[model samples]
Target: MQGATRTPAYAGRGGSRSIIALAGTLITVFIVNSLIGLFAIQYAGDADVRDQTTLARLSHALDTAREAQVAFKIQVQEWKNVLLRGGDAKDYDRYLASFEEQERRVRDRLEALAAAAGDLGLDAAAMQAALADHATLAARYRDGLALFDRTHPASVAVVDRAVRGIDRPMDEAIDALAEAARARAAAIRADLEAARAERYRTLRTVAIASMLVGIALVGAILVRTSVRRA
Candidate 1:
C-alpha cells in the first residue's frame, strides 16, 4: 500500500508578529540614539562658537588697548621732544608731525577697542572715559604746542609745566583702561574653560547612555531571535 505524502506546516502568524515587533523596537532605539548623538554634536558646536567669540573679543580688547597705550606714550615723548628741540623750526615741524601721527594711531586703536567691547555686549563706559581723558590731554598738548610755536626756545618752561600737570592723569587713565581690559579677558578665559568642561561632560553622558541603550536593544533582539528559532 502507497502511503499519503504529508505537507510541512507554514510558519505561524505569531512568529511573523514577533519578528515585526522586534524590528520595530530596534528601529526605535536606533532613532533615539541617533537623535541623542546629533543633539550632543549640535550642542558642542554651539559651545565652540561661543568660546571663539569670547576669545576674539578679549583679544581685540586687550591687544588694541595696549597698543593704544604705547602710541599715547610715543605722543607724550614727542611732546617732550617738541619742548626740548623745537628751537629749530624744522625740528619743531618734524616733532609736531610725529606727535600728530601718534595721536591718530592712538585714536584709531581706542575706537577699535571700544567697538570690540560693544560687540561683546560689554559696557564701553570705562573706555569712553579713557578716550575723554585722551582728548583732554591732546587739547593740552595742542595749546602747549601753539604757545611753543609763537615763543620757540622761550616757552619751554610753560610747555614742560603743562605736560607735567597732565602726564600723570593721562597715564593713569590709559592704565585703567588696560587693566579693565585685562580683567575682562581673564573672565572670558574662565568662561571658555567652563564651557569646554561642560561640553565634555555632556558628550560623556550621551555616550554612556547610548552604549547602555544599544546593549539593551541587542540583548532583546538576541532573545527574540532565539525564541523564534526555538
Candidate 2:
C-alpha cells in the first residue's frame, strides 16, 4: 500500500517537470516567431515606400516632358501658319522670337528632367541625343527665318521641312522615354507586391510551424507523464 502511494507521488513530480519543460520550449518558439514577423513587416514597409517614391518621380518627369513637347509643337504650328499667310516681316520676327522662346523653355525642361532621371539611375543618352536633334532643328529654323528676311520664296518650304524633321524625331524620343518610365513603374509595383506576398507567406509559415511545435511539445509532455503514471 505504501509503495503504491509513493509511486503516484513520484509520477506526479515527473509530470510537473515535463509540463514545465514543454512550456519553456513553447515560449521560446513564440518569441522567435514574433521576432521574425516583426522583421518581415519592417522590410516590407521599407520596400513599399521606396517603390512609391520612385514611381512618383518617374510620373512627374514624364508629365513635364510631355507638356514641354506639346508647347514646342504648338509654337512650330503657329510659325507655319504665319508663314502661310504671307504675314509682314514684323509678324515673322515676332513669331520667330516666340518659337525660339518656346524651344528654349522645352530644352530647359528636358535638362531638369535629365537631372531628375540621373537620381533615379536612368540611361540619359537617348535624352541627350533627342536634345541634340532639337538643337539642329532650331538652327535650321533660324536659317530659314533669315532667308525669309531676305524675301526668299523657298524659306517657308525649308522651314516647314525643318519643323517636320525635328517634330517627328522629338516625338518618337519622348514617346519611347515615357513608355520606358511606365514599364519601370509597373515593374517596381510588381516587385513590391511580390515582396509583400512573400512576407505574408513567411509569417504564415512561421505561425503554422510554431503551432505544430507547440502541439508536439504538449503531446510529448502528456505522453511522458502518462508513461510515468502507468
Candidate 3:
C-alpha cells in the first residue's frame, strides 16, 4: 500500500497568522491611544498648575491692596480727629507720624500689586490708570502733611478734601480687580474639572477596548489549539 501524502495545513496557518496580526494591530492602537490620552492629561495638569499659581499671586495682591486701603482710611480718620481736637501740638505730631507710616505701607502695597499684575498678564492700561490715581492722592496727602508741619490751619481741610475726592473711586477700582481675580480663579477650577472628566473618559474607553481585544485573542488561541487536537 502506498503511503498517503500529508497535506500542509496552509489554511490553519494563515488563519493563525491573521489572528495574530489583528491582535497586534489592536494592541498598537490601544498603546497609541493611551499615550495620546496621557499627553493630554499632562498638558491639562500643567495649565491648571500655572493658573493656580497666578490665582495665588492675585490673592496676595488683593490682600495687600485691602491693607493699604485700610491704612489710608485710618490715616484720614486720624487727621480728622486731630482737627476735631483743635490741632493740639501733641495730637498733631502723633497724627503726622501715623500718616507717614500709613503712606509708606500704601506705597509698599502698590509695588506688590504691580509685581503681581505683571505675573497675571493684567491690563497694563488699567494698572497705569490706578497708579496715576493713587499717586495723585498720595501727593495731596504729602502736601497736606507739609502744610500741617508748618502749623497751617488749612492742612486739615486739604487732607479731608483729598480723601473725599479719591476714596470712592479708589475703593471701586480695588473691588473690580478683586472681583476679576476671583472670577478667573473660578474659571480655572472649572477647566480643571473638565480636564479630569475627559481623562477619565479616555481611560474608560481604553479599558473597555483592551478587555475586548484580550478576550478575542484568548478565544482565537483556544479555537486554534482545539482544531489541532481534533
TM per candidate comes to: 0.82, 0.74, 0.64
lDDT of 1 at 178: 84
lDDT of 1 by residue, 85-168 (tens): 878889878998998999989888887877777766545886677678788878877776666654545678876776676877
State the TM-score for model 1: 0.82
Which of candidates 1 and 3 reaches a greater lDDT?
Answer: 1
**lDDT digits (tens) for residues 1-230 of candidate 3:** 37987757986786678677667766776676677667767866786687677557766766776776676667566656656553678776777677667767766766666666666655556656767776777676566555443366666666566455555686577556556656655665677578668867876776677667766766676676567656
Model 3 segments beyond 4 Å from truth? 1-55, 149-155, 158-164
Angstrom error of the Cα, residue 19, model 3: value is 15
Please, what are the lDDT tens digits per residue for candidate 2 over residues 76-179?
77667567754576776677677777778778867776777677655578667767877877786666655553366666776566455556767677667666
Regions more than 4 Å wrong, model 1: 1-12, 121-123, 149-152, 218-230
- Top candidate on lDDT is 1
lDDT of each: 0.79, 0.71, 0.65
